[model samples]
Target: MLDDFMTRATLAGIGVAFAAAPLGSFVVWRRMAYFGDATAHAAILGVALALALELSIFAGAMAVALAMALTVSALSGRGYAMDTLLGVLAHSALAFGLVAVSFLSGIRIDLMAYLFGDILAVSRGDLGVIWSGAALVVGLIGWRWSRLLTSTLSPDMAHAAGINPRHEQLILTLALAITVAVAIKVVGVLLIAAMLIVPAAAARPLARTPEAMALIAAGIGAASALVGLRAAYVLDTPAGPSIVCVAATAFALTGLYSVARKAR
Candidate 1:
């Protein structure tokens, strides 16, 4: 029974890591870490809504994340600094979500589990949601890969080639929303951004191209999930944080290697 439980948990974690890595590569490349955080922070509101309305948690998060992404994208065009707006939105949404969650009476919800994650508690149904959502996100990204790469390199160039940067941005925003929704259940809202960023960051120094970075990031994320799971089982530690720690350690090692290569 214990073995079966562990197997399911590991499989779920692996699926999540695979999905998070490629999307996260773009998040890192586009410097959208803060945007991811803002969307994730808003998930608490989604959770609250889900519980109150008896809706699917995934659906609730997707709705909230999409709304938040649209709001940020619209506000980004208003001549304000993106970082400033993101900071305000991220923290404000997190604070508001916390307060909103507190209003639920007669229910004992472990806020920490939602914030930091409870990967071991993932159900088979949740795994199905994660895999399906991830596949959709990957397909969308694949369809627009060239356009996105062009836009990332130079929006002017992309425009000259007749690729609409705005449309690509919208597509990316949608993908980010889906990614946040799926990943929240794996790493929780507070740490979801880390899972998105750290593996990609670790892969950056080792990659010569964007595609290479994405693949490397996926590998790193998968390895981290496996290793972290083992460590968690052995040490009786929390799974989510253990996974993130492994990613962080990989990032540190990569950074060191990059520095050494630079010096040589």
Candidate 2:
């Protein structure tokens, strides 16, 4: 069954959707969209690091993403504006990664694959890694759901309840890094934030509770992945961007629905 590349790709997409669901919901609630982008952009640097050190791409991406997320978390509220800091780091990381990749003269790397993903080419091992990482992310978020939610809704309340908001933020940072590392193969660094944000945003209009939003987002994400892959195959388009396009469409539809509901 897994012998089919398409089957592997489908499973991989679903796995990623599940992982993105809870974390993405938190990201939306916290307004951490740019933070997600910054962490994802840093993955390119991880790619360069992996290539340089002969390490697993996943490991390298995870390391650099974690480092970037941590750096931003640490530097936040320290005189430098959040958006400005992220802007500088995000662009710098991408530029450095691109230049570093160019320096690897002996290696013939398809940088497009890293930037835009090659989901159809996912191997069985890759599928395993995706699923494993997905499971870990899901479990981690599940364990911290209540605390994270408390922190997001009100840091003061969380502190009163003895749940350190900063610790919860760190958990999210760690999870975000893992998601970026695993998602690189599905949507690439350039579009990973779309995968994280679009589905959640799409679900926001339709869901009343946080849990419902996450579930709906997961369903939407899975649908987008499957539909996007099918559309990509049929239209001969790039799979990664195709997936993001589908998610964007969902976002638009949901936004329209929200506006129409408000008018009613």
Model 2: per-residue lDDT, tens digit, 71-169?
Answer: 999999999999999999999999999999999878888899999988988988888889899999999999999999999999999999999999999
TM-score of each: 0.96, 0.98
- The list of candidate 2 runs beyond 4 A from truth reads none
Output the number of the lDDT-best candidate. Answer: 2
Report the C-alpha displacement of residue 20, candidate 1, in angstroms: 1.6
Model 1 deviation from the true structure expressed as Cα RMSD, one decimal place: 1.6
Report the poorest 10 consecutive residues by lDDT, candidate 1.
1-10
Write down the lDDT of every candidate, Cα atoms only. Answer: 0.86, 0.94
RMSD to the true structure for each prediction, in A, is 1.6, 0.8
Clashing pairs in 1: none
Residue-wise C-alpha lDDT for candidate 1, range 197-247, written one tens digit per residue: 999999999999999998899899889989998999999999999999999
